[model samples]
Target: MAKNTSGRGQRELRVKVKTARGRKLSSTLWLERQLNDPYVQRAKREGYRGRAAFKIEEIDDKFRFLVPGARVVDLGCAPGGWLQIAVPRINALGEKSGKRMGRIIGIDLQEVEPVPGAEIHVLDFLEDDADDKVKGWLDGKADLVMSDMAAASSGHKQTDHLRIMALCEAAAYFAFDVLEEGGTFVAKVLAGGAEGDLQKVLKQKFTKVAYMKPGASRSDSSEKFVVATGFRG
Candidate 1:
């Protein structure tokens, strides 16, 4: 953040990126946006891995899914920001006296520095029997299964949309297998016409399927989250 007293009494100014020889214009623009984003600053001060943590915080604030004693599985849980948000809300630390302690398991293809109070695993969730493995770790089935995964962007808007929708669909299917009856499933997705089929499938498996763009998500981003609850088993 910057200040410009020359204009008004004391106007707050957005941090601007100075062009550097080695940096691409796109990279510079992204850096400047990050510097100006309040959520990013809050994440740094609050000790969360990234601003993405607040997206889940806002969602759970409305839906109240991260209740005490809930068992949660995070797919592609790299960096573990969502796990950090879930830990305290779900009471995973047993610090909330008289509340049931929750359990959180996070899985990714690559290992992550463990979030305290979360079980981190390096298994790929899409491979055969992956659901069984997660269930074993949970000692049965999970109460919630969530993902914040997105495929590498191909730069083409339509292609990127289809790719992320595929990932969200896969995560939903995995949730179907691992979640106990009446559980919840949440995952990030890009808003585009290609999501219809995925929405149809989720509606079949879960009693309520809704979409939301949390306030923490950038207004310019097409990203949104699908929150399906009351899994029918």
Candidate 2:
């Protein structure tokens, strides 16, 4: 039923989903892909909300920005997988003796189920006064401002790309206003031609801007993450 990639020479098993009377072909294909995805299986075994958790986990592992005591703000943090990973990594629970306690704030347009050690609010990050409100929640600037938000797909590929790029750009500016100097900004963006301006702005505002597609991300997906560190603000 599932592929095992644990051993070096093990054969991978691919699961096939047959379309049913009520299910669309696209839905069946998606289901099959999810069923065979190693990351999805790993998430279930590890008790994570979803596979997207590994994307942030791998990225933070390479960058090491989610250190103990770091104050993090997650934009559009729904389902709370990122929040769950951030809690322990950042020492938000104060369970790590001798480590400074960390804090995290999450905001989404819809109400999300609670994740221990994270403060989640039902608010849209794109609102005009959202940055100010976030600062109020954090009691100061944040050491990290990360986003995993993507616009609702319109089925038009180019239009979807533009929409995500715009959302990423807005998140960048919001980070500029609320991130601490020498902090980090991370967000997901679809690979498309319209990201030039977004990259340019991040370069101007951050000491280093790096792009990566974590191993947990689906290979066929165009999604990539932008990690901008050392915020000028």
Q: TM-scores of the models, in the given order? A: 0.95, 0.94
In candidate 1, which residue pairs get closer than 3 Å at backbone N, Cα or C atoms, i.e. clash? none
Kindly list the per-residue Cα lDDT of model 1 for residues 73-178, writing each as its tens digit.
9999888899999999999999999999999999999989989999999998989999999999999999999999999989999999999999998998899899
By TM-score, who's the top model here? Answer: 1
Q: Which stretches of candidate 1 lie over 4 Å from their true place?
A: 1-11
Please report, in order, the local distance difference test score of every candidate based on alpha carbons: 0.94, 0.94
TM-score of 1: 0.95
* Cα displacement (Å) at residue 137, model 2: 1.2
lDDT of 2 by residue, 1-233 (tens): 87766774576778788889999999998899899989988989999999999999999999999999999999999888999899999999999999999999999999999999999999888789998999999999999999999999999999999999999999999999999999999999999799999999999999999999999988889999999999987
